[model samples]
Target: MTLLSALFRNQEEVMTFHSRVKLSAYDRDLGLFIVANRDDKPSIKPLRPYQMLVLTTKVKVSDTRKWVEEVFKYRGNTELLQQFMEWEIPKFPVSGHMLKENGVPGGKRIGLVLNKLKEHWADSDFTASSEDLLKQIPTVLSELDIPITR
Candidate 1:
């Protein structure tokens, strides 16, 4: 199965990610989008490429409505989905299988490194190239204590 299948796109799994996903809430301390629960407790999932795909794709309609209705002092013209528009979202330049091909093993750790690289890519204003992202895998593997093979 692809990353979309095994990881992100499970409807029952990621939840209505919009309900928890605070796209507007970027934590300066962590440099990540913060996710808060109904009780106001913080929780986070690794923002793997697939999870991002799932989140972005699903977040549009309902969240637009919520922002339209609830959020206060909003600067936008209107908070309606009918007026929704998407600016450029940078496509992440790498994937789990790409990591595998580069000798990073499978499973949860793939997600961990992908999340790291995604952050790095986004932090670069999406200018980071695939080769730049891929080169980090070895270092990331080492950080995860996965021994690198020749």
Candidate 2:
């Protein structure tokens, strides 16, 4: 059976659908999903795990924007904060429970947290190397007011 079928075999309703089945590969390492059925060829798709989570969970865009502004106040760099919010934040695998614990009532809160983490890792030195920044992820999360537990 194809990957998608194998993954959803127990979902009778989904399995019975008559439309052409689409195949997508989820990359755990990258936290991304690649759609393979487009034009009968596999292509890199911009499906992030957090995007899926956000879709299933209700998120208020206004709240998210407000959180972004709050994060900007803490981080103090509009350009970097915006980039971090748009790109890095969505890559984080966040759950409803985690969001609630972190005072992130919606996607905006999550974005704020992510931006905070990014800023924390930067340690007031925006020129930090990539390797150094990556190593600080866990520490930054732990130090945050609302810790992120795996």
Candidate 3:
């Protein structure tokens, strides 16, 4: 069976998805990132683990359904939503929770949070501080057992 299938079949495995911080026009700052789940075991030949793609674009009025479809397309093997609630969100720093858990800050979760923030901002009595918005994203990125600038 493929690694994807195996990983799926065994749900208890702890697999890490790695990404290199690179440049991209997709976001204004922090650059765009490419995430590689180590379990995929992509080969050097054509059609790499790049087999699947999930793209999340921001929208103002409503939740983007595309995020739901795309995430499931590539993430069916992993219980992504469950992990979001269980591990990713609760364990990470609050700011990182929304970003990493929901695939936001860089993916769909960012959009979702932004939408909520907008709603809260619209309320005259509920105003969040700027620091509140920047709370989760660490100014420094920790990886490879080292600290690097984010």
Candidate 4:
């Protein structure tokens, strides 16, 4: 018999193998890390690209969420927080990935960096030009000890 038949002696085994293969494929294609525990067995889930980057930068996931919440609390604007959650936060992973790809520094204190960005954006009278915003990026990066690339 083939490798599949050799590995799965019965119909039940064959089904289980197929199910696992499908789940693994789905996870790989979608950039998702989902875990399901079955039959008292531990499930292993690999880290996603962005998650790995975050870990490498030594940023705690809880700290990031706390910073987001603190900014929301400081502003006391539900609508603005909603917009940030709906729009900006989702883009963070993609942005992080791009920065990593470009050899940009990943600072250890990502929470502080995020808080600064939030403060800049939250200012009611703040009207920074695109160039001004770009300049601020390097400043934040420097504060985080992330090397500035030309």
Candidate 5:
């Protein structure tokens, strides 16, 4: 909520998808964005769960209704948003407990490792299993340059 509120820097009564600000926050955040020309022609891309975590992190829960309405209204197509409404990202198969048992130190490191694993999971289109993600722990940790106390 605070993220979204602080993001739209324009002084509008209601925050809109238009990039009134210099940066296109949606494209950076959700991989979805809109472009408008002087002719009032707008090209708006529908939302996608590129990073499953980003849906909640970037898009404000309270503004979901308004956000969906605005985007769909422009698109004149409701199917994608409908799918987004029904679709639920599966729970990550790997857990912090599993990481700990495998020698990952607790605290912020656990979250970093998990987030890296989740990136792999998302890359696999959310099909990676617990074992699959767990196998990548060492690689992910190395990529993150965390010391291998494991």
Candidate 6:
């Protein structure tokens, strides 16, 4: 069965994706508008290719209303989901439980490499997604209260 079918197998197992699309208006017929007039007349420049992004995911429909709600969970925005679609399902990131605190880099790409190393070192019984280990990361971060500046 398809992945979508699998995700929605039972209502209990289903994860809802509340997708939102915003498209800009473009006048396709405006061929002459491209010709720069010597008069320097202001013309409506067509918008670039419309951005297609999924705004949010929700277990309950109302969760999409405010993204910052305490318990709200979401999977991706448009760019994130687009990249996720391209990712190979077989390749899952490793949890960095086994690594030293110094091992995780300040950058995301380095962190990914560190995760790959963790995956390689994982034992037979150890699933890469150990919840106990995952929980520790945030706990440690919270203790440090590291400011994440965009």
What TM-score fits each model?
A: 0.46, 0.22, 0.20, 0.27, 0.56, 0.18
Better of 2 and 3 by TM-score: 2
Give the root-mean-square deviation of each candidate in angstroms.
12.8, 16.6, 16.4, 15.0, 8.7, 19.5
Please tell me which model should have the higher TM-score, number 3 or number 6.
Answer: 3
Candidate 4, residue 19: how far the Cα is off, in Å: 43
Q: Model 1 — TM-score against the truth?
A: 0.46
- List the global CA lDDT of all models: 0.48, 0.38, 0.31, 0.40, 0.56, 0.29
| lDDT measured at residue 3 in model 5 versus the true structure, 0 to 100 | 33
Better of 1 and 3 by TM-score: 1
Pick by lDDT: 3 or 5, better one: 5
Better of 5 and 6 by lDDT: 5
lDDT of 1: 0.48
Q: Tens-digit lDDT track for model 5 on 4-113?
A: 43344443412354345443554333213221100122224334332343433345743443444344445555675576566665777888899998878888999889
Which model scores highest in lDDT?
5
Worst 10 residues of 5 by lDDT: 30-39
| Among all candidates shown, the one with the greatest TM-score | 5
Sort every candidate by TM-score, greatest first.
5, 1, 4, 2, 3, 6
Who is ahead in TM-score, 2 or 6? Answer: 2
Deviating ranges (above 4 Å) for candidate 2: 1-110, 121-124, 145-150
Determine the backbone clash count of candidate 5: 0
Give the number of colliding residue pairs in candidate 3: 2
Candidate 3, residue 137: the lDDT equals 32
